[model samples]
Target: MIRDIFENAYAAGAYSLAGVVLMAISFLVLDLLTPGKLRQHLWADRNRNAGILVASNLAGIAIIVTAAIVASDGRLVEGLTYTAVYTIIGIAVMAVTFALIDVATPGRLGELMLHPEPHPAVWVQSVAHVGVSLIVAAAIL
Candidate 1:
């Protein structure tokens, strides 16, 4: 039915917009936690460390989006609500995980993430970020 298709399209669009907005919010939160300007480091300097961290942040968001889609079970209202709720949770967990990792390591993760030096430790942290996201997504499902 055309109406069904339209509704599905609208739901998808809404979720997509929500995902993007959540990503921005996550970015701002992460930036605030760190020392340097994330935008400047990521854009002007093209710092790979920052880039890696940002990528990890995106992976966290992706996990929530996937979980949200599954939890929604093809319902528009459920999809929107689940995605929104899970996104916030996912971001929060990710920040906590990173902070914990920083505490365990030699230096602060927020500062380490912005460091221009490319190190295996950051890669490990990035993977951990994704790992935490998986756990959060699994809990949501």
Candidate 2:
């Protein structure tokens, strides 16, 4: 019984590690899309727009990871695979959406990332991230 418990714990840890890696990758993707270093904007500058966008991106990744784990049905290998693939897809879609929104708008989206004030464009992009994640999660199910 103890061995079974330990094995389950190991599986859980594996899934969690996979989720963390995927989340970090998503952050990098967002950092590349925005202006300046994300850490500087988020930590030193304390930019609300960057914070909102990063928060939404992380939440979206969590949604995708959760859906993948649930759909895995206790299969560790399959769960990790699904989580990684879905996360990559989610990131790609979010990047493309960001680009499209930038082209459709007046000024540069990257410029807005460091605007120091709350911007409607940031909120729209945030919603887009979460919305795309939901769509990807639903597809996983």
Candidate 3:
């Protein structure tokens, strides 16, 4: 029983670490797609558009990770692999979505993130991120 407990704890820890790493990757992806320094905009400037976009990206990652973990069904290796793969796919899709939006819209998407006022486009992009994540998550299941 104790061995089983230890194994479960280890699995949980591993999954958690994987989730955090994937989230970091997602953050970097978003940072790359946005203009200026993301940290500066998020921390010092406290830009609401950047904040909303980032929050949605992270939440999308969480949703993907959760779905991957659930689909693993107690298989650690498979879970980690799926989590990473799905998260990467999610990030790529989100980036492409951003690019598409930029093309279809009036101004540069990345530059708009730096705007002082909250832009409606940012909200649309944020929803797209979560929507793509949900599709990926559903695929995992």
Candidate 4:
């Protein structure tokens, strides 16, 4: 029984990881394909630091999705409702957390997320998003 559970969890985690990789690649491609005008207004011109910020946000989403998938134990059909709920909750939590962190640290978070700097906050937010996703996924499951 224990072995089975572990195997299931491993499978789920692997699935989730693949999803994360796909999402990251997709976002990167989209960023590359985006027009200079829209990109400037939405991402570049605003702060000239949109790349990392956008990447971090995308990374956070991937983490949340992964957590939800892992929490579902690979039972996507059965866990559809749980995944949706957890995704919503995870997004909300991440938004709030980012807001608070931004307020507390000023441009620090933005610099790391928006700029090309290595921001620990990105990891922190990703972890939190994943954690919340897992909780909500588990509750629904």
RMSD list, candidates in order: 1.3, 1.0, 0.9, 7.9
What digit string (tens of lDDT, one per residue) describes model 3 on residues 50-124?
Answer: 999999999999999999999999999999999999999999999999999999999899999768898888899
Model 1 lDDT tens row, 3-40: 99998889888888988998898889888877879899
lDDT, candidate 2, 1-141, per-residue tens: 999899799988998998899899999999899878999999999999899999999999999999999999989899889999998999999999999999999999988866898888899999999999999999999
Which residue pairs clash in candidate 2?
A: none
The models' CA-based lDDT, in order, is: 0.83, 0.92, 0.93, 0.54
**Backbone N/Cα/C clashes per model:** 0, 0, 0, 2
TM-score, candidate number 3: 0.96
Which candidate, 3 or 4, has the higher TM-score?
3
Tens digits of per-residue lDDT for model 4, 1-141 = 999899778767665665565455535443443334325634545643454445555665555565566566657554444445555565566556666766787564544554444556656655554555455445554
Cα displacement (Å) at residue 135, model 1: 1.1
Model 1, position 64: C-alpha lDDT score: 83
